[model samples]
Target chain A: MTASSDIDALAAMILARELESALSKRADCGFQLLSSGQEAVAVGVAAALLAHDQLLCSGRSIAPALARGLDPGRVMAELIGRASGPCLGRGGRGHLSQPSAGFFGAHAVVAGNLSIAAGVALALQARRDRSIAVCMFGDGACGAGALHETMNIAALWQLPLLLVCDNNLYSVSTPRAAALAPQRLSDLAAPFGIEACTVDGMDVRVVREAAVELTDYVRNGGGPAFLECISRRYASHSTSARETRGQQELAADRELDPITRLENALLSEGALSAQTAQALREQVRAKVAAACAFADLSPLPVPEEAFADVV
Target chain B: MSSEPVRTRRVFFREAICRAVGETLDAEPNAIVMGQDVGAFGGSYKEFYGLFERFGPARVRDTPVAEAAMVGLGVGAAAAGLRTLVSITYMDFVLLALDPLVNYAAKARFKTGGQIRVPMVVKLTAGAKGQGVAHSQSLESWLMSVPGLRVVAPSNVADAYGLMRSALQADGPVVYVDHKRLFPTSGPLNASAHEVPFGLAAVSRPGRHATIVTHSYMVCVALAACDELAVSGIDCEVIDLRSLAPLDLATVCTSVSKTGALLTLEEGQVVCGIGAEIAYQAQARLGPVRVSRLGAMPAPVSSNPVLEAASLPDAGRVADAVRRLLMEG
Candidate 1:
């Protein structure tokens, strides 16, 4: 397929799979994995990334890692705690890691991934290689010292790193207005003199287009770019976590349900047929089911080897 | 175990640091030093003097005063197959670089499910002696708290060279600490550029009377204490622990298991210091034995030489601890 067609296909695959899992005719439809309505944000930015590009995903942006080449099967297993999971059933849903796939785990510690991504990107820079390191964090990470330190260093050295912030309006129950001093998360990069951009996270293309520009800028020694993709979360913070969190999901979901938006766009443009979308939905469901089955059939980890990887 | 007579040597603490680093670069082609002013301007401590001229600018890189960035770059360079020795002037300065050292470099191997290996050495000047409270601080205890980090503090001239060599060759991130006080003090090296394995213990002196467990500069103090104790019929076996993370407990325990008495010395505060860990380890091996810790008494270090001496362990105190332990035994 052509490059344009390829991007479209990738977008379609992301929307279809995520929609089937998050909102579909399946029995487990409306089963929320991520709390934020940021599926489009992941699909968009992930489409712009090269397969070899590394990702240090923070506590937010769960869908991005999977889109960026992490085996969806492994992630599905990881979310439910299965032997075949990428994290070996060690890390729960929020902490899945697949280093081989360049998907570093989601760290709860705010702005923790910035330094990690910067370091990895700096390593790539020293080698003079053309590989981008993507760090997807939330608004909370902007306030962290690690982010500022990393951004300053990254900018000074002109490291190839993409620091994307999923400004999901709130950190759990607290609104962004209550936590961050600045209204826009991208503005936090101004002090470090790093390039910053704000995007419409509801439309995945906006994120993808911005990601393309940012990726080029990063590789060309424009330094780290802070892209604030303002989106909202649909689910509660955790499993059945109902305490009236910030960023009303139903309204945001209506305006920015990535799967629905993508489907409408592709259908209207004659790029994707409704029949094709339906087929893709079924295929994703089947794939997830097969993954669940594989996880069930897999053997339990050796009890003695519980602390195998830990120092 | 070098029988060769000591050759004439004179390099000031700063000069020796540069000379030693230059020597390391001379020895290994893959080895490079990178930090702020490490290239053209030499370094804050002049530890990387003349390196820019001989090794070229790329090998002796000058990074911005961003410790996190510099440390992260070191980790990256190490993983990309370069033996990088990144230095921050003081141990306290490592606070800025703790993220890379703690999160990325140290936990990379374990967190990645043992896929990647970080082989980098961080040369940090530890301990204080009028370098001011900010510059003169020991963060070895902080480093020890981190898992997957090999903490090495070479008390004197020989171990400084040996520790740097070993840490460069190590499979993981190694924190090579050097005290400001012991950098100038000349001592016999077993062999210049020899690999002093990370977990090996140095028997500074062999004696059967009492086992004095100490490391870094304190090893010299313990050795001198043995001389003083000789007059008082108390001979102390001073074991200089070179490595901290994978502490050479076998060597210290063997010494303590034999002498049946242990004493720990630290240049930092007395509470929750390296001595406490050594005491716990020694006691665990050789059933309950009274251990003496020689260090500062919870207060900030005094600027006065005499007051500093009081806070720091000296030969006199080490000898007294030995005599008292013997009396009790």
Candidate 2:
């Protein structure tokens, strides 16, 4: 593995961990959403894309924002509903977007943003730009009719779009087995003749490798591609949920935590020493602390600006 | 009509709309047209029959039979800097795509604090034409209720051409509704480039006794009713509200104040429709004085033409509505 890839993976884990922890504390701030075990998938997708390429994400995927290099302080501010945030506090935590960073907001609606990403790709194709459009959605979004419609058009038009399905098993409280049929979500692409693959989402290196390969294929004139990452959620679906799934399931998923998996792999491969990993974790914790301070100092949006932007 | 060069050779309403779309696509490179059969097979109404042959598939795209995804794609494309025109084919089918149209496209700019703009036009065909319960309904009022959506309906051929250009040029999203019944109706087409701005009502006919407010195909019925009322000395002033969202209430108020009476005609349902809003606003502005509304009955329009006609307001029904309003005094 390249030195840059190792550092990027470590940094991504730290940022996701910090955001999850901080957001966990603010339980009273409406609903609590987290992308805990799906960090590797989001980070991998983000790392695969070029800087100019755009990312359309779902509300649960904050790792994409951090991986795209958005300011952690600004991310926190947006989450806490601060005026200094990317959306001026109008989007709150779920609908955060930084256009300059190529992170085009996290849509609260499932599969809705996925279709929009296809449009973004169409726009890029219209302009003859080499840049591609990447969209990240959960396993539940895979069953939507909108996704099927989008896949048809994306393949028929040969659009430059990469669809990443973060299959972390449950969508709110429903299990994938009960909701989706035919088991493999990647089969959704087969009817459209688009190339697809499934990867172990807990393995950051493997996810990144798949993302990079698929993104390259899409960036070229190879049309749209799909990458399904088999992930697991260590935490509950939301921050407020008291039930922590089944004990056996939780314990099994916890053992496959992407962050721990990456750290162990790095240490064993001599890519990162145990001491260095410890230092990196401490450094990220302190940085997140500073971001929390910045978020605290951020102001609320003035009431008078409420009616602005209606047009 | 008159020997005017500005009016194109008495072409049908569909031809006028096609001309306008062709002209806009010719002028703007970033503008794209997409719908279910907009490409390859042309449009459902033949509004874009020859566009694909002229502009190729790059600009004219044929999407899957997915209304929600189609609208979502338009919203995304518009925000990404391309002016998009997405067609819903039938207005009744817009129900399947309401989530994206009402939630995503309408709230995108506002929720993003104006950092993004969605300059898109959704071309929908409405009004009853024996297409059946699921296909034949007028839902312009539903779109009118949306905050960020601009709802415009053109009753005549000239307005159709002019309003489409204005919709494409507007800074925000526009829901341009066209009546399916008006597809074959031919009228004097103005060849000159013109634009009908939003929030302005067109006085299709002038009178002094009562003000008849309506839009879309109902404008024709309202005009016919005006002629009948003229014989009875009611002299109804027919005002066609071109844009519903940026409603031209000032014009309606001016006419209401002059006429001292108001009557609203619409093809949509009588309950909570555009006519109801006009009556409410008229009462609010000028204190209710013989105000009455005529619209389709509160039921699904049937596949049978006779049943559809009975449900919808016609010239005779509009005239009767006006007569009832006058008789109340």
CAPRI class of candidate 1: acceptable
True contacts kept of 2: 0.58
Worst 10 residues of 1 chain B by lDDT: B7-16
The segments of candidate 1 whose C-alpha lies over 4 angstroms from its true place after superposition are A1-36, A78-96, A104-106, A191-193, A239-242, A246-250, A309-311, B1-32, B56-59, B76-83, B188-193, B304-307
lDDT of 1 by residue, B1-329 (tens): 54665653544555545656777778777777877777778887666778899999668877777787678668755754567889887788899888778876776665444556777889888776775657766768778878788999887666676677677678889898888777667655543446677889888889887888877777777888888888867767888898888789999988988888888887777677888899998888778986777775566666676766666667887787777767787
Positional deviation of residue A223's Cα in model 1 after best superposition, in angstroms: 3.2
CAPRI tier for the interface of model 2: medium
lDDT of 1 by residue, A73-159 (tens): 665555555566666655544556675676655654566667667766766665667887888888777676677767877777677
Cα displacement (angstroms), candidate 2, residue B297, comes to 0.8
Which structure among the candidates has the greatest DockQ?
Answer: 2
